[model samples]
Target chain A: MKNGAVLTVNDLRVYYDTPAGTVKAVDGVSFDLRPGERLGLVGESGSGKSTMALALMRMHKPPARIAGGEVLLDGVGDVMELDDEGLRRIRLDRLALVPQGAMNSLNPVMRVRDQLADGIRTHEPGDDRDALTARIRAQLARVGLDADVGGKFPHELSGGMKQRVAIAIGTSLSPSVIIADEPTSALDVVVQRQVMETLRSVQEEIGASVLIVGHDMGLMAQIADRMGVMYAGKLVELAPVHDLFTNPQHPYTRLLIESVPTLMAKRALASIPGAPPTLINVPPGCPFHPRCPSAFEPCDSEVPLPTSQNGRVVSCHLYPGEAA
Target chain B: MTAFLEMTNVSKVFSAGIIRRQHTVAVDDVTMTIDEQSPSILAVAGESGSGKTTLARLLLGVIPPSSGEVIYRGQSVDDLSREQRRTYLREIQPIFQDPFESYNPFYKVDHVLTVPAQKFQLAATKQETTRLIHEALDMVGLQPAETLGRFPHQLSGGQRQRVMVARAMLLRPRLIVADEPVSMVDASLRATILESIRRMKQELGISVVYITHDLTTAYQIADNILVMYKGSVVEAGSVEQVIRDPKHPYTQLLVSSIPQPDPSLPWGAEGEIAGDPESMEVAAVGCKFVDRCPVAFAPCAGQRPPLYHEHPSRAAACFRYDDAPTLEGENLDLVFERQLASQPASGSEEQAAN
Candidate 1:
């Protein structure tokens, strides 16, 4: 909390109380966001990447609950301690969320400009309407959308255009922190590149800390300054973008990197065996042990603690001499 | 050499509205061949409305082409009888884009694999059917026991996609029309599905028509590549030859537009490559890509270039290659230069200087 970090989460745990049992979506995960830095949260489906983002924003529903965590937003105090009113105040003005599948997030009947205006009016009351409108127009332009799109309904715009509008809405308030969940997944390759670039440039322009949750490593590699690789409900590796891609430490991280298709490497793609374990009843010991090619006896019996090496933190027994 | 599946001038047009005033040319005059021996992975690459999906559907005989003919095993697809059509379907299977949509959500994942076995009567008993399902599942890297009873939602996106691949493999089809098969799966799991397709092609001699907008994945898995723009093939060749040295301007743009994984390299900010939506709305005599073609000449706006032979195993629809004495004589540098010239003076000069 005292450091220059924009956001810091410590010993975070989020669970879902399903009919099956208590599902540990995010268990004992921790990471930090520096001011104006872009941190990518990457994992396969059900890797707790999205869950971590939701928990940080305290957006989980009745069935899904944050078991324990300390989400400290710099200058604003702990996010977990905030009530509904405090959370609402923090949402648009301080921390903005670009939800996943935002193409469908907009109301079909409402004009996009009105939606943005409504969001602003609800959060920052009695603000200059014209000034806010001008800001919205600039934001839309920044994301490669024209100002005329503000008058159109959600259904009138293409998927890519809608996503850009979503970005415009999220960044309209100039929040201190922005959490974008799978922002480019629904877009085509060309639009995907455009949207990611826009998101990165916009974040830089605003000087706001950004958290991107997605499964696409290539897209993440393009924007992320640092990246966190999650498996099941734990943070397996957290390192600079280059380090994660070039010299990944965790077995899961290595596997994930290897599995990504790129123009440079044309070798036979290797898939990690078995699917991700269900959160309802995650496997004991190391969550990734079942799929980890290098997993040994200790991996099935003991959980590895995150150990730091050269500014990178890795939670794996593969890093020898690292304590659990 | 006689190809296994050959589509000649195949086109599909769908009409909407009460007056039928609007027409969508989903597939337009596409001609390609899948050879018999040493079958290659042919990728029909394009964005939405590029007709790649419609072309796949046409090739699979799910929806017949409105014009021209699809030849399967030396016979026209339309000429086949009911029994012959069934046989053709058995030989040529389709792997849809969404695995979740491919199967009923209520049914277990194994049901998809089991139906083919039952229909083909390949299994004498329930045990044999189960065995066949397991074998197919194993081929696609899915454990039979783990996936058998699970619903679509129960399995992860990767697992569900693998199951769909298993279903496709159950019939032992000689050709697969995989329409953006891995697009929906997680990026970490996409390579695995692609690898399965590659393995199926190598081991089982199954030819795959991989339809996708992702040029990177196309480069990874395809042997032969087809670059489509507005329902027509602009370029076609060996993946290595085409991707490494793209002949057509459209292909070049696509290849360059692919975002490099290296962060050091600048994101190629060649202004938005705008395809003429209006051109696709109405049939035209000229090239479909003329508006977007940076190297478009006067002739490009007047006449649609034919898919002429470029090399021993390559063909492209570009005026640049038309006058070359030999396909190798075609000047790639000159095309790139012409393209640079066609761009607005300010941006091109700045880009060139950079």
Candidate 2:
């Protein structure tokens, strides 16, 4: 909290209480979010990136339960310890989440302006209505939306615009930390850039730490200050953006980097051989062991301890005997 | 010197809305050739509604072009008879963008692989179908037994995409129309899907028409590149020439628009303002990219540029390179001034309307 780390999650585990069995969606994940910093949480589907993001906001439904660990917000106590009312206050005023498929996140029946006003009214009851309207308009403009767009219905705006509006509404409360889950996945290249730029600008304007959960490494590299590479249900590598891309230590991280098609590089990309393990029945050893090219005997039997290498923490057997 | 597939002035128009009054031009006057012996991957690179998907659909003969024709093996795709169409389908196949949507979520992953074998009668028995499915799965780096029983939802995006590729390969098609095939897969798994297709081209001598907006992947896999902007081929050439040494203003803009993985480079310095979405629906004259084109000249407003041959392998539809008489120096500047004046005062309004 002293270092502008707005949110600190340690050994956080979230599992789905499904009828079949408990699905370990997120397991033993630890990370810190510095104020105004952008952290890109990257992994394929079922790697538990989305689940972890949802768990941070404490927004999971009945079937999903936070199994263990702590999520600390600056100036606020443990998130899990908070009662329903305490969580509600934190949700609207301190933490905002831009969920996945934001195209549908908006209230389809409500006008865009009314939606923003509704959020403001619900969160800040005593705030002046005129002031709220003006603020919403300004926020919309900040995200590159027209002031008139507030009057239009959700279906009236394009996918990119709808997403921008969602961002505008999400940041209206001026939260300390914002979690955006795959915000630009459905957007085309040009629109994708615009949406990403909006997110970057919004974060800058509000000075909020942004956690972007996505699978696009190239896009993540463009915006993220630091990145945490998740595989299966575990965090494999966490490093500064440049270090993660250029000098990855984890076998899984290397595979991720190598798999990205770069403009300058011409070598045949080596796609990691196997699929991500099922979260319900994860492999016993390193979650990524089945797909790791350099995996050996210990990799399949014992979970690799997280070790620090060149300013980055990588959980891999490759970085054995290093400082944890 | 016969081309494997040649698209001559192909255009596709779709009617939208309840009354079906709106005409959406998906592919517009796009003409290119894929040579038989060249063994090169042709990238049809553009964003959604840039007509890349329509062009892919046209090539696959899944949908007939509204105008013009696609020639396959020196025969027109539109004119193919029943048996000929079947042969054409055998020669050309498609790899869809969303692997999850490509298969029935309820069915097992191997079901997609076995369908083509059964359709083409490549496997007369269950055992042969099983064997072929295993071989195809192995080629895509999947263990047959492991993938055989898994549902689409159970597998990751990467695995499902590979299964789609394997299904395409089962037909042993000479050409593949991959429409943003890896866009949905994870960045870590994209190279694998791309490599599988590249391997198909190399090992089986299949030509690939890769449609994508990602220049990075296009640079890696495409031997030749075609940059489409608003239903037109703005530039077409060898991948190195088009990507490294682009000629058209549109092509240059697109190549530069790609954010490099390097963090040192400041973001948005090379960024192009998003195009007016309404412009796609308009019946544009001159150049479709005139509004966004930095180097657009006067002739770019009044008259459309033809695809001018620069080198034997390269062609571009830009007044700067074309031999059109109206494209003189001062005139270009005058045209640029007029266009700037004619553009809507509020750029954001254009986006809002869309």
Candidate 3:
């Protein structure tokens, strides 16, 4: 792992083996997660944002496999090289995942308290029932739920409540890195705001680095300190949230930022001219060049590596510099 | 002037539970209208379970209202004769949220367009039908050559939705009831879909009732806005008035909750938290939003607040607007007329000439 980073991903590539060919879902993505920092990954449906989140926690199922990458954790060794027992040992205690679809994440038959206790018991089996109960109450309280909520089943909770319970379970052991995949996708804006608030507060209390993955740029701008834009399975631009919104560098990033409608102003939304290329067989050179407005000669023939200058990293021919 | 379509005191109640038969008011007493002479977009903005879909169903005559009438050209929809009903279906089209579900996987994409043309007898022969299909597809900005021979699964979500827009355009409907058209689409593609819908108003001079939970898109494209909450119209006015300066407490909560793309202006500190979803059971006697409303007072708990006409062009169903006169039967139409008149023309007249 890097000196001060909590998690360092190097050349991470996750691919799905289909009948036709290998679908490169997460292609050559690299980034570092600072402790207590919130980094958000924004992308469209087929952009591989969710796939990267699952692959980071090594939770991707069959057909989807991590091709080659180094997911190095602080104190812990390389996550990609970890065996079954080693991966299981470090999963919830050192790293956790709050998956998508909170409505279906929890067990329907189990009580909220029991679902929480399962994670705790798996890690620390020696804890007594009273201690577990106390810990469960504290976890529920931290997520702004009442102690009585522990006895209720998953079906009894609302969409926002289910998400809160999911967060409580994820942060129960105080993991160093927490990956939240579209934690507020199905929620209404009002409930979304409340749930995000709860997630942020709980993350702060635990001092865990959050890697939130979603498509909503507005929601990402609110919660994420640093933002990464993904297109065609590649991390095209990574910059601080403010700079990314204010002065987006990559053409795709700029188009995405301009596409979002705002309440304060009304302007013609800049729709990207073309759709994202299929990842099954990505076009050579830059994947975003086809849709990019300022497509030069090099953009069609040569891939622009991530160029870092002034704490901003953008992959585009317009910014010529040493690759990060 | 006669309205193109109007819902007068419309309310729909669904009785669930076979044994107990609990009646859920899916859509409460609400009245809105679209003028035939002036083509515009009316965005019905609200959260889930806010009766946005039920309202769309009511507009499209997919479901019958329990109390009031859906009047089309001064005639009740329920009392329309067979020929009039057929004409009504041909004139008022619907664009649903999920484009994938709307298509049959077994048939080619052309099947969606061709079947409607045959049903409505839009063209006399197959050659004329194909020509009409090509023209419709071109209207929505899809290349007919690329989209015609493909199945629903072959096209991208954005393309499928545009095809659906093209399908809606084939009949040349006077009003298009688009229920959350872009909710299931990708963020990058949302603008294109919305742009096509806007073009329906501009190029074709068709009025649209765009139902969605997204306020930003509503603000971007809609001329007038109706903010729904718990099956009731909490606020209704020009999009500029309702979104920029919300009157109802629930509308304020909704507006504030929307996270702007700009990071400099972060969301404000959490105010009064919304009540839990289980506590969202509607009260039959009082304001539906009273339980979650931050400014709820004594009057809010007594009787349902009427749509108080706060301005010539705006109305909100809240006690905060108690100083304004309560809108009676014909006042809603008057206020809506003013609302439409206040906005600049959306270029529909010039484009309609083309």
Per-model DockQ against the true two-chain complex? 0.38, 0.55, 0.76
Cα error, residue A86 of model 3, in Å, equals 0.8
Clashing pairs in 1: none
By DockQ, the best candidate is 3
Evaluation by DockQ, superior candidate among 2 and 3? 3
Q: How would you encode candidate 3's per-residue C-alpha lDDT over A211-279 as one tens digit per residue?
A: 999999999999999999999999999999999999999989998988888887887876888788888
Per-residue alpha-carbon lDDT of model 1 for B122-141, expressed as tens digits? Answer: 67899988888888889888
lDDT of 3 at B172: 75
Give all candidates' CA lDDT scores.
0.79, 0.79, 0.88
Whole-model lDDT, model 2: 0.79
The number of the candidate with the highest TM-score is 3
Candidate 2 lDDT tens digits, A18-101: 778888888888888987899999998888999899889898776889999999999997998999989989995799998777
Which ranges of candidate 3 are over 4 A from the true structure?
B337-354
How well does model 1 score by local distance difference test? 0.79
